[model samples]
Target: MKDNFYLGVDVGSVSTNLVLIDEEKRVVASIYERTRGEPIAAVQRSLILLKEQMDRPFRVSGVGTTGSARTLSGVIVGADVVRNEITSHAVAALDLVPEARTIIEIGGQDSKIIILREGVVVDFAMNTVCAAGTGSFLDHQAQRLGIPIEEFGDIAMKAEKGAQIAGRCTVFAESDMIHKQQVGYPLEEIVYGLCEALVRNYLNNLAKGKDILPPVVFQGGVAANKGIRRAFEEALKCEVIVPDYFNVMGAIGAAILAKEKTKRTGKTNFKGFEAAEMNFSTSSFICQGCSNNCEIVKMKLEGETVAHWGGRCGRWEIGEVERIAKEQVLS
Candidate 1:
């Protein structure tokens, strides 16, 4: 555990992020890639890129896993610490702003609101069912209006008169946008209206019962959209701070978690850069061990079993592949 660097990976439905942080919890190497239907491959590619960027094969003192695909990733990379997105995000936020009261995060597919009390999570809510207020929905609307997504903020700012567009769901919002266009409403107005409507909807629905105090920090892919940032600022009537690494907050937080875990346990489980060069193969199978029928994924290297995950019964998780291989040899 002599090395001071830690590795963190956050693999979600839409994207895979890898971040390397030093002891100070500052990101040293960070890479984000689209999940592209293969979380494992995306992670491997990111790790390989990280390896190439480093001066040499350095010992990874600690490794952490987070996000929807975290369990699988933890098994694959021999994670030193496994944490959920909520913990990872909150930890990273506290590191940046020691007294942050509220956190607003919107990724490609989901959005969340976390309320903090003295740097601890008091309550939180997430909306994964609705896409109306999420980043991908905004991207679609920008495409339909023939405007670049990056310019969404500038257009919103210049909007003198805004139109009313439904923000209940994606279906209703798209139709409302079309109706506004049909009625000769300006694209900027419609865009601005949509932005406001989304923020309003998020506040009314998710942030309704929660106590949203000041010092709010917005982090996620949507935070890059100025229109959305302005919308949050105006809705909350407070200054919203967007961190320098807004999009990669989860990964950064995971790295921080890895660092903290290593310092506590004083152990390093990182497999090293040799893991990048390792010829790994992964495959999935439906486990009929129980009525749950979990879709277990297994990884192998050089014809030797490495890991198996995704079984609720733990039948396949207890060295089944290795024991089976040995049994095959004995037979």
Candidate 2:
């Protein structure tokens, strides 16, 4: 009997993650690669890598895409379901921790907080304007301190007390770190201090007006940092849980969603593994129809337009002919 799997792809600004889940909702294969500003290439490379990692042959019965580039990725992979990062993260968190009341996710470029009550999302907030509370900022600090990002948490764990650092903005944080170094603060103390600062910033920005209940799960690239986890626990006065597969939770959530969607339809739109070999391209143009001037993005496969997105009114989603006709009627 052939093994069946569901494929999920999450292409974000900083990373592209892919996860393959079996019918039992267990992760079979996963890939995490940097997007490096080219999401199409990253997704293709991730797909190829995931295929090579699997020892046995498997059939992908469903495909889902999520993250910042969900629409573009869906067009490339022929996804059965396309969702946003919020929905994908919430689903994955609920799957892992059914009683999870709060989810704190800090990715490479942004951070988000989700509040759930009885398995339903009640409220959510995201901080995209600031990088001080995100993983990329931590990575930059690690590099500045001549420390490997992988060892950051362990080093921070050695500090008995962290130094105070400003967390309102990345610029201020970096300046504070430099000043601390100049003043002869211990490296570990400074590192942990930065972690605490980021936690404070997250709470102040995203978790400010909401009720952050217990069973708080922290999942994202930043969750790998033990220092940040400790900081959050100290601030919230509760234990924070980090799932084993924190980095790829978005992709896992996407896969789970794909499975659910395909089960109802009894079919899939997966383009098969061969999709990795296909040539995909994207182009964008500013719409002149309205004051919003929404930048419309068009995705092309094999030199043919396959999808259109990134508009305030979703006018481009209806295809070129219909969009033109609608505009004419409106005029």
Worst 10 residues of 1 by lDDT: 319-328
Q: Encode model 1's per-residue lDDT on 206-303: one tens digit a residue.
A: 78889899899999888988877888888789999999988889988888888876887799777765666667778899987778989997888766
For residue 43, give model 1's deviation from the true position in Å: 0.7
Instruction: Encode model 2's per-residue lDDT on 190-276: one tens digit a residue.
Output: 999999999998999888989999999999999999999999999999999999899999999999999997888899988888889
Query: In angstroms, how far off is 269's CA in candidate 2?
Result: 0.2
Error of 1 at 194 (Å): 1.8
TM-score of each: 0.89, 0.92
Q: Which residue runs does candidate 1 get wrong by more than 4 Å?
A: 1-3, 54-59, 318-331
Q: Which pairs in model 1 have colliding backbones? A: 153-227
Runs of candidate 2 with Cα error greater than 4 angstroms are 286-294, 312-315, 319-331
